[model samples]
Target chain A: MSFPITLTVNGSAREILLDDPRVTLLDLLRERLDLTGSKKGCDRGQCGACTVLVDGRRVNSCLALAVSLDGAEVVTIEGLASGGELHPVQAAFLAHDGFQCGFCTPGQIMSAVGLLREGHAGDDPERVREGMSGNLCRCGAYQGITEAVLAAQGATARREDAA
Target chain B: MNRFEYVRAGSVAEAVAAGAAPGAAYLAAGTNLLDLMKGGLATPATLVDVTRIPGLSAIESLPDGSTRIGALVRNSDLAHDPGFAARYPAVAEALLAGASAQLRNAATTAGNLMQRTRCPYFYDPASACNKREAGAGCAAIGGATRLHAVLGFSASCIAVHPSDLCVPLAALGAEVEIEGPAGSRTVSLTAFHRLPGDAPERDTVLEPGELIVAVRLPPEAAGFAAHARYLKVRERTSYAFALVSAAAMLRLDGGRIAEARLALGGLALKPWRAEAAERLLAGRAPDAAAFREAAEAALEGARPSGEATAFKIELARRIAVRALERALAGTPERVPALPASPFSAPLANPLPSSGAIAHA
Candidate 1:
């Protein structure tokens, strides 16, 4: 049976019309809404390519049912930018050269942004590695990815001070 | 993944009522369940999504001094909670040791406990797995089992319970509060996870329609004195399932072992407690010899599947001993912390000190 779901996405309130009972938020975002920023790599939740923010927390949208998320807020990679300005984490990904194919870049950026906003920054590299361990890059670009996040932290601090 | 009827529950009792219906399952976080559904491993006719239900996601301390962890508490929130990090450091460490920051941010506490094994055969539809199909013979017994269990193996199933939190919680004597059609009943954390005897299909003793509200941990002196370690040895250093992991809590009086609680992960059908090994450490002086003996006693009955993986027993033993030693040493040395990014700096290599080995 088709269920009515009202979800806010990328700072816009969306009233989606879904028919399939098995359709997930990831499917709706990509297929229905054309929010193709979130990749569908390894739909088994083993890969972080489908990560998005549901109620201010990073979730693998492939595993999140659309009907189950009624009246909830969802954030996709497309929403990370404000007035065409990339989020600090997204900018950092570009600065650090965090992607090769860029298939997993969106999810990685989303997860990193969520982590940084939640206050996981520290002087330790191991802590950062552990924090960002969820997103996997097949190109083995972890070294660059880590550097970008650290660099982003510095930039974010500067922005905070400037404001 | 299938055309299952989705029901958003309003209350815990209503959720349990719907769950009691045949082929109905509770959907919390949906990390594991949705993954299994997409993989064609599990197809429930009905899914009772409990996310909208009130009072199932709050983390509060009970009036009895016990900490009540709601079933829907996110893994990230639980790991970062000051009380959990302070009182149950092992639990926090284990949660962090499992998935990456992103997965934990969405994965729920109850979902973590209910996560299935990452066995290739169990995930593949064509492969024979008793857990997936009742009469299907296990392909893992003679096939690829490098990541399979070393302890608590039966002919039927050998896939280990994949939760890192339950191992420490089981060791610390936590109780699970479950409510169902028959009313509420509290099961000891030790008894919550069941060993795969003949029925590998049944992972826990929870009856149908029973929803777990919270996991209550009683305040004990032993729980506070508890020094714990969660050693996750995977193929890669980060974001990988454990090959063989151990969580050990050691209590010391001066320099002698007063009590020890040992639990093994990625090596059993359930979160396994090395009770026999712990019995060997009571009253013994916390030393290298004592640690070796305890490790040996715990791994005495272990039977490995292959020649390459037999070393896991020895590796698990050593890691267990070393982790306990480091946690008990009370060493003030702080390793360089890593940045929150994928690679902010180089990993500092710290060798395990022999003198720091505790009997527990």
Candidate 2:
């Protein structure tokens, strides 16, 4: 039996129905909502391709069931753009050459944004690598990805100073 | 995944009631359970969602100078907790060592303890795994078992319980507080996870419909001239499973050992406590010879299964010695004292883009 589930996604109230209690949020986003930005890499928790934000916290959607997300707030890569302009993290990815095949970019960006919001981005490169180790890219674009997150941290800091 | 009835439990009592029902399982963080269900390793007929139940997510200090971690507390939250770092550094380090940031955010304290093994045969439906089936012959006995067990293994099953948290839990004499349909009970961490003796199918001593409420950490007196460390030797630098790992907490007195607690991971079906090695360390001063002897004592009875795993015994010993040495040299990080930070930090470098990557 599919139950009626209402949650906040991208700042909008959304209703989703799920039959199997095991149906993951990754499936609902990719299949039901057609929000293909969140990629499913391993389906297992090994890969971070399906990373998303639940109540401003980064989570692996592939391991999260849709029914468990009732009344929770969700954010996907699709919501990264504001007023048709890319978020600072996305812009930093472009500047830092943070991706190649880009399959893991969505998850990487989502994770990076949350990292910055949490204020873990400092000058240390090792810290950056450890924080971003969750998302894996077969293209071996790790160097660029790390650089992008660091760059985003600087930009966010500058914007905060200006404000 | 098969269809299963679902109910959002309002309280711990309700969740236990639902879980006690035949084929019912509690759903806290779906990081492990959902994946296992999709892989067809577990097919529960009912799921009791317990995340909605209040008071199941707090990581608070108890009156007894111990800490009580709620069952629904996320691994990431626990890892970053400042108090956890100060008191139970090994527990936090173990959490940080397992899984990625994203998975850690979703994996709960109870779910991570209840996670199944990563054995390939256990996930393969066609493979004859005694863990997967009650009476099937064990294929891992002769199959590719480079990642299989080296101790506490039986002919029935050879799969290792793959939780880094359990290692420290065993060494620190942690206890599990659980609520069930029958009543509430507490089980010591060492006795909670059982070995795959004859019944390889049972991973934990938990009864059906029993909900893990909290994990209690006993208070430890400060000033162990000895230090502690968690040494994980894995296939990769990060995000890889440990081939053979060691968690050791040594208390040094006058450059000699006052007390020692050691546990092994990735080599046994359950958390392998090195009682033999621990006995050798007590009252003896910490030194190279003492550490080596302790390591050897820990591995003496370990029966290695495969040709490649023969090295794990030695590897585990080396890690134990090294970890003890490090612990003796300096203070080991217990758990973090602060609450979990919501921000994500930069981990690695940005991927090189043809169009130039943007800097933050």
Highest lDDT: which candidate?
Answer: 2
Evaluate candidate 2 and give its CAPRI docking class based on DockQ.
medium
Displacement of the residue B345 alpha carbon in candidate 1, Å: 14
Residues A21-76, model 1: lDDT tens digits: 68888889999999999999988677889989988888788878888888889899
- lDDT score of residue B262 within candidate 2: 86
What is candidate 1's lDDT per residue for B1-360, written digit by digit as tens?
A: 676888889999789889999999889878888889988888998899888887878778767777889999988788788766677777777787777777787788888777888888899998898888887888888887787777777888777777778887887778889999999999987788777777787778899998888888887623534566566666776677777677777777777777887777777877777788788887888677777787777777887855555877877787667656644653112211321111212113323344222222
- What's the fnat for candidate 2, on a 0 to 1 scale? 0.79
Model 2 misplacement above 4 A:
A161-163, B221-226, B332-360
Candidate 1 local distance difference test against the native: 0.77
Model 1, which residues run further than 4 Å from truth? B306-308, B331-360
